[model samples]
Target: MNRRTVVVGTLVVAGAVLAGGAYLYNANQAEQAVAIANENAAVLIRPNSPIIGPEDARVTIVEFLDPACEACRAFYPVVKSILEESPEDVRLVVRYAPFHDGSEEAVGILEAARAQGLYVPVMEAIFAAQPQWAAHGSPNMDLAWSAAEEVGLDVERARIDMRSPAMVALLNQDLADIEQLQIGQTPTFFINGQPLTEYNFERLDEQVHEALGN
Candidate 1:
């Protein structure tokens, strides 16, 4: 065979090998997802996990998030867009990881707002003002509180509510699940029970679409 034919043959072989590898990896991941879905549903989907979207939606994206995580702040819009685009088909469930120094405080604030029926507004306000308060090295939760209050959260009541044992237990339960899953990242996502092994907008979109069969 000539050099061109030999080169083409080599490329084709390499392509097949890569494709096989990808297929095997996907199969393994799919099995793991199925196991998690069946055996770990109680841990993954507690009643108090914050949710946005329809309960009956076919696709559920569970996000293990830290309010102080810069990456989570960055990806917020990406996840929002996905939900907006697939309003009827996709749902989001947020579980706090609170990995940062002040993140547990932020989580408490969020739960307080939730108790007062201001969860979404307060969360958006806090997220919008994240940089002001979510200092990686030395966070000031006072700023986060101010942001929440600006969005109609009753600061005094929220403070009292945030200190409640119910809220503390809620955060602890989420942390327990995070530990059980061995999730080490702030914005880890699971789509339709499948852990997103790759983190990127395109990969996230692809996984959601694959689950939707779209």
Candidate 2:
């Protein structure tokens, strides 16, 4: 290429890189602002929310999860591993963000399961059968119910409890947090009230360890 042409091309490439870098910086700043504003973990770790592991654990991992979300199902084991690895140091708090069709009903089912003292088993069962019941665009809710039944959840009683005022109130609070936190995706995680910028095992592990001061 000619010298002038090469110089022009280099300038264009340099400009693009600068612009991209600026965008990333701005985005990171905005995310940090949001994280700072929403650091009150108590708003999410309410009495009604599902808790896995020691309630008073030092490291709290809050997950905004949609039952029908494939990503949520995929992350279940990862979160489970974090708890299993350091049961006394880490705990998981789940907040429902059921954006997909029929996923709200699944959340209701989980609430009912909680009432029945079967939340953990039912949740595990649902995740295990997520593909069959949580199919994208055309979920098979019957299969979800069946999975709950297999885990000994009383479907009939659960239906009644799902419609209870208490369940409605809990769901409303979770929805409000979803909006206030500007959560646009399922399985959004926060470790010690700081949001996860990237979703990956290593990043999550790092955050967990950081929270534990390890």
Candidate 3:
């Protein structure tokens, strides 16, 4: 081939290689984006006590909640109703991430309940009676204790468990995980390994159907 023809061929080949490289780079970035999203969306399950839900559910809803947050309290019933209504269709994972002043104690209470295999019941009671305990002023250990007692948790054992080093470490680890995930608010949810911008029954229902391919 002539020199000009050879030069033209070389330029075309170089352009093709560059375009291929860019395409590969973009594809790799997309893959990484998905991986990061999935990681952020994953719940750090506590050891020993597993969350309750169907393993093969179409959607997994992971909630990072604060026991002392009023909004979380309000959202609790909504979530509970959804789970109750469609126990088989959706899996719910609850993670404690206390951000308020009394939140530490609340988390400790939850950990204590988990130790006694009464986490779900105690949590349900706490959320149900949130109006009675959660206040704007100071932490109310007495009210929390009352709620625990009402839920049939061994109050003495729960108090002792609340002071355990293991419980403290668990809360600390959860807080660290929350920070790592950059979670900024209570009641944050992840749907099918994707962080949701907003959470509502309608949205959750829609996402569940999408995930299930229904």
Best by TM-score: 2
Off by over 4 Å in 2: 1-30, 33-42
Candidate 2 lDDT score relative to the true structure: 0.79
Clashes in model 2: which pairs? none
Provide the lDDT at 40 for model 1. Answer: 76
Q: Give the poorly placed runs of model 1, Cα more than 4 Å off.
A: 1-39
lDDT of 3 by residue, 1-214 (tens): 4323433444454444233322212556546535666776443454532365887777777788888876566555556655665788887877777877778787778878888888888888776666677775766767877888787889888878889877777777788778877666776666777655433334544565567676
TM-score of each: 0.81, 0.83, 0.74
Candidate 2 per-residue lDDT, tens place, 93-124, comes to 99999899889899988989999999989999
- Candidate 2: deviation at residue 34, Å? 4.8
Pick out the ten consecutive residues of candidate 3 with the lowest summed lDDT: 16-25
Tens digits of per-residue lDDT, candidate 1, 1-214, equal 5323433444454444233322222667657756765577667788978889999999999999888877677667667777878899999999999989899889988999989898878888888899899888899999999999898999898889999988888888888898877777768888877787655555677788889898
Report the error of model 3 at residue 14, Å.
62
